[model samples]
Target: MKKIYNNLTFRVLTAILLGILLGHFAPSTAAQMKPLGDVFINMIKMVIAPIIFLTIVLGISNMGDLKKVGRVGGKALLYFEIITTIALVIGLVVANLIRPGDGVVTTGLATSGSAEAVSRYAQQSAEMDWMDFFMHVVPSNAVGAFAEGDILQVLVFSVLFGMGLTRMGSSGQSLIRAFDRLSKVFFNILNIVMKLAPIGAFGGMAYTIGTYGLAALLPLGKLMITVYVTMFLFIFVVLNLVLRYYKISLWQLLKYIKEELLIVLGTSSSESVLPLIMDKLEHLGCSRSVVGLVIPAGYSFNLDGTTIYLSMAVVFLAQVFQVDLTLAQELTILGILMVTSKGAAGVTGSGFIVLASTLTAVKVIPLEGLALLLGVDRFMSEARAITNTIGNTVATVWLARNENELDMKRLRQVFNKEEIDPLANYDY
Candidate 1:
């Protein structure tokens, strides 16, 4: 009983339940609990920049072979594109078949708060350009990138810095050691911040339910149900088949990272658990180089869940507005989503912004239709964040296996709950 009470998983699960109850009873009080969640996420964000910088730099410096780095990055990007495209297709197909938005009345719908939310995303979307996105990746000032906490910009700078260190040969040995030590320090900090996850989870759940009461789900219930079902199929059918080919059990992996999943579930932000997942993957025997490279890159490039949601949301809105899209128009949506979804990373309210941009580009769906979804988007965000976390985890492990960097023996032992501590060296 003591152990159960002390367990992080149990604590977070309990917090979620308590949060829901509080929200259901005293929504005004529960809404004020937002600060707890905000503070927790801020704590996590504090270490993310340093961790990404140190991890990527250290991983690349130690790799010793530049060609292998290029090969790994190439393969990872290829995998991301293929897998995310498949996810988009699956979302499109599922939305069309179910037509979750059909037969919905859209006259004089309550767009009070929703209109303002949609307007903000629409403005952001309008300002975005493909050329500008590519240009933004190359930070003009490295310190600015870190200060702003832009993951892609930091990733770009880190890769260059790592490559420069690799060119120094024996001269860079001291620098690499310093970076390794720094990484440990940041991970230790992460360990400390994680203790507040239950508080964060509770606050997040309470605020979500309080701000948008459970009754908000009733009208858009069909779209919500369809989105959840499609994501479920993608995980079990698409992701499961990929894992089985590599002789890994999806169930086992889920069990191993169940704690992180629960965190993401409550927080509805995959970024909240980024450091923990990276640490867990390394402990599971994935190469530090691969985990370093793939995870951050995956956060931006491999957004399987967001892509699925974007594609489905567009289709749903069109159905609600009684707009009939031709096959070519639908294909255009797929192509547009492939690019728009990638832009979602590092931007707040990006999922909606990306959807707004896609709808504007398509010029078929009424942009006003977006008002219908703003109410329920928060509820669906948890599903998207969880699926994205799972997809990236699988991608990292699979890439590690392909590169011959995974230790199967250690993996087996850890899964079996043996006493072997993969983090023993790091001392986290």
Candidate 2:
């Protein structure tokens, strides 16, 4: 009983319930709790850049073969694109079938002043230059990349730095040891920061419900149900089949990462568990090199959840505006989303901008329809974040097994809950 009470999952679940109650009864006060979530996310972000740099550098240097690094990276990217595109198709198929926006009354959906609400996203979308986005991957100022917590930019630098260190061979062993120690220090910091996760969960849930209220979802309930069910099926059906093909058990893998899932559930940010999950994957039997390369790369490229949401939102908006898209137009929208979706790069608010860009490109869906999503978007982010987190985790494990990098015996031990967990033993 005492152990259960101390459990992170239990505490976070309890916090979520308390937050819902407070938001319902005293919204004014609940809104003030935003800082709790914000600060906690900031705390997690505080360590992300350094963790990525150190983990990648150490993993690369230790692996001792730069060609293998490139191979693993290529495989990871290939996997990301394939899985995410499938997710996009799943979203479109489900949305077209259910047609959540078919009967939505646009006027009552707070659409009157929607232009003002979504204008900033439109502006951001217009300002986004995809060439610039790809170019920005090579950080002009490495310090600025770290300071801004730019994962992609930091990633580019870390890979090169690690390669450089690896080429030094025996000459760089001292530095590698120092980096390995520093990485452990940061992981310890991660452990300390995570203890406050329940508080963060409480603040996040309270702020969302207080600001939007359960009533806000009523108007968009059909869309919400459709989105959730689609994601659920994608996870259980699609991801499960992938796991089964690889001879890995989806249930054990999800059970392994349940704490991180709940953290993402409460916080609505897959990034909140980014570094933690990387470390957890290594302990789960992935080589450090594979975990390092796959997880962060998956973070940006393998956004199964975001792709699903983007496709479904486009279809939903077209239905709302009574725009009858022919088969060609729908295919064109799918093509447009394929490009625009990558523009988000896992940024928090950028998902909306990418959606705006997709809508703008499609030239059929009302750009103002983006505003209809604001009230219900937070509620759906849990689904997106959870799926994104799980997808990345699965991708890493799958890639590791395929590359013959996973320690199958050790994986069995960890899944069996027998011994050796680098991330604390949560017995959940």
Candidate 1 per-residue C-alpha lDDT over 1-428 given as tens digits, one digit per residue, 9 for 90 to 100: 99999999999999999999999999999999999988999899888888988888888988889898899999999999999999999999999999999887876555577778778888989998888889888999999998988989999899899999999999999999988888899999999998999999999999999988999888889999999999999999999998888898888999999999999988999999998999899898888888989999999999888889999999999999888999999999999999988866778888988999999999989887888888789899999999999999999989998888888777777788888864554221
Off by over 4 Å in 1: 108-111, 421-428
lDDT of each: 0.90, 0.89
List candidate 2 segments past 4 Å from native: 111-114, 421-428
Question: How well does each candidate superpose onto the true structure, as a TM-score?
Answer: 0.97, 0.97
